[model samples]
Target: MQTPATPKFTTREFRDVLGNFATGIAVVTSRDTEGRPVGCTINSFASVSLDPPLVSFCIDRQAGTFAAFQSHGHFALHFLAEHQEEVSRRFAKAGEDKFGAVEPVAGIGNVPLLSDCLAHLECSVYQRIDAGDHVLILGRVEAFSSRKDLPPLLYFRGRYARVASE
Candidate 1:
């Protein structure tokens, strides 16, 4: 195996560089073994495969909800709408009740589904790989919903942005 090369850029520099690329905000939700809901705001989500209907997202290894997501084996990814910045900020924090005000319905494998998103995907854990400082989770999409009328919430350069009306 080839050895990894040393990164010349500082962590802050790397983050700043990547932040130039905009990403849609998402809140990935799941239930713990005891059936309590958990979620976190994530912008690292992506569609991994179309043939098998797979999606993926990265979670910090030290996140408060990490263990629950890893063991539960199911989750739902909610793509936030442009008006859901409060929801995004709420989940982005490390807290016990990320779903405090939001009423989440149960999806596949009892994963909690948030409402009013531009889109959402219900998935089952397909695979988990160790990535630097995070875990890359691949999920098999089981169900999904979309509302084309709603614009997505976006993050760019450490701030929230919007898609201009066409």
Candidate 2:
């Protein structure tokens, strides 16, 4: 008789394994009280529903941008293109001026959208659920726009990659 395979993995191991699934990179931006831009690179973004237009992403509790996102009540998610890896790295880094070196335009109530993203979504905070080590943020999509010519920036296997056109 053939035996079925058994799986054995830790949380970190599972995360690393799941990282093989390529995802589009995004910069989730919000304005601080002083109206300064705060952004973070998030690969966890996903579309939730179409009827009500909902989207979701997870923010690490320890991330520097967490407070800004929490207090702002609104945010802009800019899905980066394959060429925007530098932009993604800039936002992902700590203690760096993410917007200082990049030109961003104000969209949908002063939310800053990176100039050349594949798509931009302006959203309002809908709800938050506390998960271990991360907070899942649900946003009500207020407005959105996209560019047909752009291809999404992809992340997989701990690196940034691009999709090749057929």
- Taking all chains together, the TM-score of candidate 2 against the true structure is 0.90
Off by over 4 Å in 1: 1-5
* Model 1 agreement with the true structure over 1-166: per-residue lDDT tens digits: 9999999989999999999999999999998878899999999999999989999999999999999988998999999999999999999998657887778898999999998899999999999999989999999999999999888899999999999887
**Estimated TM-score for each candidate:** 0.95, 0.90
Q: After superposition, how far is residue 139 of candidate 1 from its true place, in Å?
A: 0.5
Q: Evaluate all candidate structures by whole-model CA lDDT and list the values in order.
A: 0.94, 0.89
Which structure among the candidates has the greatest TM-score? 1
For candidate 2, the lDDT comes to: 0.89
RMSD of each: 1.3, 4.9
Task: Write one digit per residue (lDDT tens) for candidate 2, span 50-132.
Answer: 98999999999999888887788889998999889999999899988888868788877688888888999999999999988
